[model samples]
Target: MTYHHTQYLEDGSIASTLADLARAHRILELEGHGDMSMGHLSYRDPFGRGLWLKRGNLALSEVVDDDFILIDFDGNVLEGTGLRHIEWPLHAEILRARPDVNFVGHSHSHFATVLASSTEELLPYNNHGIWFAYEGVPRFADTCHIITTVPLGVDAAKTLGNAQALFLANHGIAFVGSTVAEVTLTGIFLEKAARFQVDLKSSGFTPILPDPEEAKEKFDRIYPPKAQHNFWTFFNRRLDRVEALQGIGISQISLPSAV
Candidate 1:
């Protein structure tokens, strides 16, 4: 457990806000019931440079301020005890190409994983699926792995462009957001959409794609910015309580472990 972000907030500035956002995604990755220590949530530092991201494959239930790895925009491990996620390139690659993006969340969520196992787009059955991506999703069918190599991740990022979500075929899910809270909610809704897709497939009713106008209308409202922040606000307070109970102090969290 090499914890890079020991203080939770670098300065007293945005301390509570930053910790809440960090803890929100980690908690969702835990409560959304995904496999722990595998998925992650990340956000670019606004009012500054560098990024705050999860050190991959750590137990979500055990996530502390130290588990958050702060890195430069260029993917340097700016601070933290543990090595960055092997897929760090993807985070930098996407953020560099899309400045409008504030956060990116990825997970090997169950329903989305099924699509990764197939050769199909996770199309919208209604407004819920389209709420994140105004202009339908872009599925990268290429054969790449881990985003370990720099150029490989860049090319994939180029293919992504402005889409809110990209279903990486034979891989996993990528969600872009205007904030950590937005992306976190996107992950929740994405999994919900996925579960609905799976259930509909089981029910044998053809999904009626929403009209373009309707899709645009819905995307703007469902989990809007304020609502996203509000949900994160509530969720992270619960997490902070847990963090307090565990006594996740800088001394305990700052040291690195096997990870």
Candidate 2:
């Protein structure tokens, strides 16, 4: 699983992709994915070498294109330099298990983690929940320990199955998708949907969930490739405004209309 060449490091396309990955980190941070540098994201290398993981010791907001290290499925660092996260196997095994998944993210966002500790299911209560309506979010209660080993990673991946996301019981969340836009939005929407469920329960009202068939139809109509691209664009624009208001420099990353 080791790759020798570092030629991809200089590839402009790869650099741009990493830049988008970095933006995803920061965007998620703004949307409550910030857990004081504990969470991480990964992109399956275009060259088939390995995944480019966010190096440890930095908060999600602190990540940039140069902050990633290329590591193989065996957890060996193949390129770049930094202390790797102990949870590398979480990203490695998921990407290895899902050929259609190019991007993966793990975070301890408040609501999602809160809902993960409860027995209630995530229903299609709103648009945010609609994305996951077809394949309900599954829970992985195997162990709360860090997924640092191959077997544990494999088991977590098994729990994930065909779902776009998984709840790691009382731990955090793991989400995967085919592109950066899809994965990042999935994380954001999952958190929002969980927050709504938590609030609904606190209100002591029995919430009505949308019909399964109707939810599946809505999911198909609203989550097409073009819609995904539009959602990503909206978030990037929102991020731009946030940076402006905070007096932070705009990201130099040349984001594409779609990832």
Candidate 3:
């Protein structure tokens, strides 16, 4: 079946969302989760159509509105020009499998990768980590080969079933969300949680794991949908001030609320 972003292109929401996504990538880079150049963030088409992803040539920090390309579930590049990420299937398959998910983030971020390679469980040592307690995160234990093939992506998606995030063994972390803000915030927090967990372990001190019940209560109170919009606004403001964004046009784009 032919797929296109015609609906999103006309509505203009896609343009705004693409800018936000590029900003999210830059934010991840500034936070040091970019892993040199192997990180990506994508959004499902507004009409539940295709996926919008960054071209492989641009660094996460340098992504702009024009850097995004549209693709179908089979990884075929439907629009735009340039190299598609070899891991495109990872996003495509997961979006295909999870109708609830609208955003996907992947990064060989330092802390998360280190934690994933270890035998230690990602314990809930803090509020940031406690959020994962609502639904335990899964680890994709398959081979760490580049997920260039459709089958490989499908395997990764199977491992990620119904969970918000998944750690690829010896690889990195992939996060999914029902909206851009949720996924972006979760990605940021998850990276923070990894840092906290690793730091405590390295110090040889026993960390206090948050009670699941209390954690749930705290999560509900602190991270309702509205909180995501607040976060998006805060982060977008930060992006606006970054020196590297001078020519990126993100500041000029009137980004719609990410809720």
What lDDT does each candidate get? 0.65, 0.84, 0.77
lDDT of 2 by residue, 217-238 (tens): 9999988987887788777767
Instruction: Give the per-residue Cα lDDT of candidate 1 at 145.
Output: 66
Model 3: pairs clashing at backbone N, Cα or C within 3 Å: none
Whole-model lDDT, model 1: 0.65
Candidate 2 residue 239 C-alpha distance from true site, Å: 1.2
Question: What is the C-alpha lDDT profile of model 1 across 1-259, one tens digit per residue?
Answer: 2223333333444444456455655566544525646666677766556777877657545455556778886788766777577777777788888989878877676677666667656666754577654655676677646566778678778878888777777677778877656676677667667766777777777777667777677767765666665666565565566556664321123212211
Q: Give the per-residue lDDT of model 3 (tens digit) for 1-259.
A: 1112232123448887787677788777766566555789899988756899888867677787778889988778888898889899999999999999989999887777777777667767877786686876688877876677889889999988888888887998899888777888778878878888878877877777777788878888878787767776676666656744364422222312212
Task: Give the winner by lDDT.
Answer: 2
TM-score of each: 0.78, 0.89, 0.87
Q: How does candidate 2 fare on TM-score?
A: 0.89
Q: State residue 218's C-alpha deviation in candidate 2, in Å.
A: 0.8
